[model samples]
Structure formats: C-alpha cells, structure tokens
Target: MELSFKGMTALVTGAAGGIGRATVGVLAGQGSRVWALDRVGLEQEGVEVLTGDLRGGVLLEEAIARAGRVDVAVLNAGICRPAELEQTTAANWDETIAVNLSAVFHHLQRLAGVMKKQRGGSIVITASTNSFDGEAGLIAYNASKAGLLGIVHTAANELGPYGVRVNAVCPGLIETPLTREAFDRPEVIQPYFAALPLGRGGQPEEVARAIAFLASDWASYVTGATLFVDGGQMAAKFGTWTEEKAEFAGGRWRLKPEP
Candidate 1:
C-alpha cells in the first residue's frame, strides 16, 4: 500500500541517529513537511532540523510551536547504557529512564494537546524488542523500553476520545551506529541470529518503514498496538538455524543450498 504524507507535517526526535535519519527521509520523501529534531545538528537536504536535547521540555515545545500543526510525531530519541543488574548504576538508571521514558511522556503530552485540538493525528514511539525480553547487560535499556508500553497503552486510551492514535515499533538488532560494534563481531551475531527465524539483523530503513506505516493513514484503525520489526527473533524459542542445516557467513546465518 502507498503510504503518503502529502502536505502533512511531521516531527521526529533523534534525527541524527540511524533509525531517526531513515525515518526523516521516508516521511519527507513521501511529501511530509518534516521537522527533524536531535541533540546534534542535522544537515539533511529537505528536512527542517531542530537541534536540542530531548530531556529538556523546552526543545519539544519549540518544535511543536514551529511546526504549527503536527499530523505525525515520532518519539525516537534514546540511549542504551549496558550493565547487568548488579553492575547497573543509579546514574545510568536515572539517565535511561529520563531520556527513554520520561521524555517520551512529556513529548506525548504536548503532542496530544495539539492533535486533540486538530481532532486527529498519529504518534509512533520507538520501543524495542528488548521491551519484552530480558536481555542480559541492558537492565536500564530494557526497563526503559518496557515502560514505553505502559505509556503507549495509557496514551492511546486517553487520546482515542480526541481522535488521536498512539502506537509503538519494536525493533530487534537493527544495524545502527549504536549497534555497529555488535554487527562487526561475527562471533556475537552468529549465535544470536541462529535463533532468529530470519537469520539476520534488521536495518534502520526497515524499522523506519514500519514507523511510517503506523504514522500513516494505512494504519487508520491501529492504535495502542506494537509492530515488531524484528527478523522473527521473538518467535523462536529453541532456535531455528543450525550449523548442520545452515552456515554463518557474510554476517548472517543462511540455509544450506539444496542439492
């Protein structure tokens, strides 16, 4: 289906990052008047860049005000500080919760008001597959992501009455700069991807497409829902690919060629 954002206005946070950059391109290419927000300055050809930290509510308000009217808002800014429960510091926890969860709440609150007045809009949050699974060494990241579901549910319910829809996209092992190290280590991904039915990691563009769908008219009836952009990683329990039946090559697992 064609996802068109012709003449619409969109606001995207974390626009300097992988998924954020891809989302900006998708929305803008589809005809949306896109406003890209990030802590660092962005130099995209057609996007109106808003440089500021998401933790501060001021930048969010500024973007909303400048946009004049927001038809779609992508709450995508986040940081991942990996540490096991025993090793996770209070400082790390606070920072993660602040950026990943608290900031999202504030953004949603402001966007809800705008959309409510307009009587319509879509909000797509960048949640993660870690939101559901207890991945090791990511106590704070996992907690923050899980907390987003609560926000999605609550926001969708309250905003529905005002003709606003809220949803989330849960990506798994997307190849962004944040994850470049992991993607570089074949030893790390071989075992991890073996369990994934798709036998590979995802790309930022893939996740962006999912975000676009949720933010577009194509998902007119979808709200308070989460679309997993994982490569079937969440579906397998005992693992899908095996050394005997598949080979780990070119950074991913692939089935053996048929004779």
Candidate 2:
C-alpha cells in the first residue's frame, strides 16, 4: 500500500543526516512539503532546509511558524556523547538534556498548539532503545531518551482530545554517519549483531519508514505508542529461546535444527 501526504506539511528536525535525513526524503517523496531543521544546512529537492541550534529553541519555533499548517512533526534531533556516569560533568548532563529532552519538549509544546489550531496532526519523536535499556557509559543519553517517553505519553493524553496523536519510534542499532565508526568496528557491532534476531544492524530508512507510518493516516488509531525499529533486538532481550548455531557454513552462521 502506498502512503500519501500530498497536501500535508511535515517539520523534521536533525534533517542533515541519519534517520532524520531519511525521514525528510520519505515525506517529500510522498509529496509532503518538508521543513528540514538541523545545526548544519542540508539541501534536498522538495525540502526547505532550516539551519539553527535546537538548544536555543528559536530555530524550532521559527520552523514551526514557517510551516503554517504542520500536519506532521518529526522530532529527531539528539546528541550522544559517551561518558561514564562518574566522569559525566554537570555541563555534559545539561547539554544532553538541553538538546535531547528540552529542545523536544519546547518543539512539542509549540507543535501541540499548531496542531490544536489545525484540529489534528501527528507528532513522531525519535526515541532510542536506551529509553528502555540502560547503557554503561551513556547516563545522560539514557536519561534524556527515557524522559522522551514521558513526553510522548503525556502529550498524547493532552493532545488526544484535540485529535492530535503523539508517538515515539525507538530505534535499535541503526547504521548512520553518527555511528559509522563504531558500526565498522567488529568489537563494537558484533555483540549487537549476535543479539539482534535479524542478525544485523538496521538502516536509517528502516526507522524512517516507521516514522512515516505513524505520521500518516495509516496509524490514525495509534497514539501514545512506541514503535520499535530495532530488527528484533528488543524481542531478543525478552525471548525465552534462541536458535542454536551449529557451524559456520557458506560464509554464514548456520543455525542448528534449521526450520
């Protein structure tokens, strides 16, 4: 089935690269006028790139105002600076919250008003698997992501009456420029590969597809929900059984008792 947003306008943050960039492309492909926001500028067909600091909230507000009638809002801007909890400074923690959580809250607050005026709209926030699971050296990142879910739930409840839907997309280990170095290192990505039921990482477009679905009428009934685009990583975490691997064959890890 084809999803169309022919007359819709979408506001996408972090549009320069990664899943944000992919979501902008996807929305534009569906004929939605996209307002792409990021710290650095991005130039793409069918996209009006807006460059600014999300922390300041000025750019975000400007983008929302410029959209005029935003049918969909994708909150995808975030930063992950890895530092052990003990080594994490107040400055580090504040910066993370400013960009990841505060910025999102501000955007949602403004978008909620616009959508309320329009009488309806969908808001999709890009959360992380860390929102559920704790990572060793990412205390700030983890906390910010977890806080995002609270925003999603609260916003959904408040906006529901106005026909505005709010949801989050929690992505697993998706390969993106931000993660390129770590993804290229076997030591960094091998464990995720083994734990993921899909036996591999995900692509930005994979998560972007989920965002588009939530933003579109296809998920009209869905709100206050989180769609996991983790290639089964979360499922693997809770699965009762696992497929045993026999031996490496045909340049692949062969499963025992193959179905």
Candidate 3:
C-alpha cells in the first residue's frame, strides 16, 4: 500500500524525541506539510515548529489554528518515570500522568472537534507495550500508557461517525533517547532482547513508519486498533533466544555460528 500524504497537513507532538522526530521526517517526505510541537524548539527544513508544553493545551490549539486543517495528528508526546510502586513519588506520578495521559486527552478532544467539522482525519497515538504488561520499576509510566487505550478506544468509536479514525502504536524497546541508557549497557539489553524473536531492539524510524501508515489513507478502514511495533516481544511470553542456540553481543542477541 502506498502511503502518500501529498497536500495534507500533519501535526506531531513531542517532535524533539526519537519517534516524534522520525514521524515528522516520514510525513514530510511523503509530501505532507508538517507541524511539529514540543517543549524544546526544533529546526528542520520545511517544517513548522511549535515550542511549548503539552499540558497547557494552548500550543496544541495554536498548531491547529496555524495549520488551518489537520489531516493527520500524531499524539506522540509522553514521559516515562521509572520507579517501583513503593518509591514512586506523588509528583512523579502526577507529572507522568499529566504529560502522557492528560495531555493526550485534551489534544484528542480538540482534534476531534476539528476533524469532525472537516469530516475526515486520522489520529495516531504513541502508546507502549507497557500498556499491556506491568513492567517493574515503571508504575506511573505503565499506568499512564494503559490509560491511553481508553482514550484510543473511546475516541475511535466516537470519531468514526465523523469520518475520523483513531488508532495507537505500541512500541517496545525502541532505540530512542529515552532508551539510550538502556541500549548502551550490554548487560541490560542482552537479557531483555533475548526474549524478543527478532533478538534486537527497534529503531525510531521503524515505529515512525507504523505511525505514518496508520495516519495515511492506506489505513482508511483501520480504526480503534492497537498496532504493536514491538519486535515480537509481546508475543514471546517465555522468550525465544537461548544461550545454547544464540549468543549475545553488540547489544543484541544472535544465533550461534554453526561449526
């Protein structure tokens, strides 16, 4: 399926981050006029950058008004605070929920209204595999991500009548700045990626491509769906790689060479 966005306008939040940056590049390369929003300022050719916090909802409104019409909206802004339930601070929990879940809700509400009037649009959310699993050391992050499904399902249901589609991409162990520390440590990824069928972590561009597809016309019939951009990690409950058949090196796992 050809994912062409020629003459369309796309808005991406968290534009400075890994997945968000990649999504902006994908949309722009596919011929869409892209507007990127984030707390940090961004400088990219042919892209409009909106700098501000997602919590306020003002920047979101500004992007919409300036773009004139949003054919696609990638609600990719989020924060992950890793702390065990006992250690998770109230401030951290509130902040994580505000950015990851609350911001999305406000943005989706505004986007829905705009798209409903236009009678067509697509909204792709940045959910995570943690949405389904209770990963240790991420009490707040997991909860916030899990809450996104409620938003995705409800939005998709209500927006379908207005010709607007809502969906989510759940990425697992992607090599983004948020995960750079984990990827840098061989000890961390060796055991973690061993559970994945691909034996490696995914890149930002890979997730971006998924987001682009869901935003594009190729997914016209797909809505209220949660697309897993994970490397078979969710499917492998017990993991597939083993030391007898595979070797861990270079921050990834690989099948051992035959003698």
Assess every candidate by TM-score.
Answer: 0.98, 0.92, 0.98
Candidates sorted by lDDT, best first: 3, 1, 2
Quality of model 3 by C-alpha lDDT: 0.94
- For residues 59-123, write the lDDT of model 1, one tens digit per residue: 88888888899999999999999988999999999999999999999989888889999999999
Candidate 3 residue-wise lDDT, 1-259, digit = tens:
5679999999999999999999999999999999999999888999999998889899988998899999999999998878899999999999999999999999999999999999999999999999999889999999999999999999999999999999999999999989999999888898999899999999999999999999999999999999999999889988889999998887788898998
Best by lDDT: 3
lDDT of each: 0.94, 0.88, 0.94
lDDT of 1: 0.94
Poorest 10 consecutive residues by lDDT, candidate 3: 247-256
Q: List the residue pairs that clash in candidate 1.
A: none
**Backbone clashes in each candidate structure, one number apiece?**
0, 0, 0
Model 3, residue 57: what's the lDDT? 97
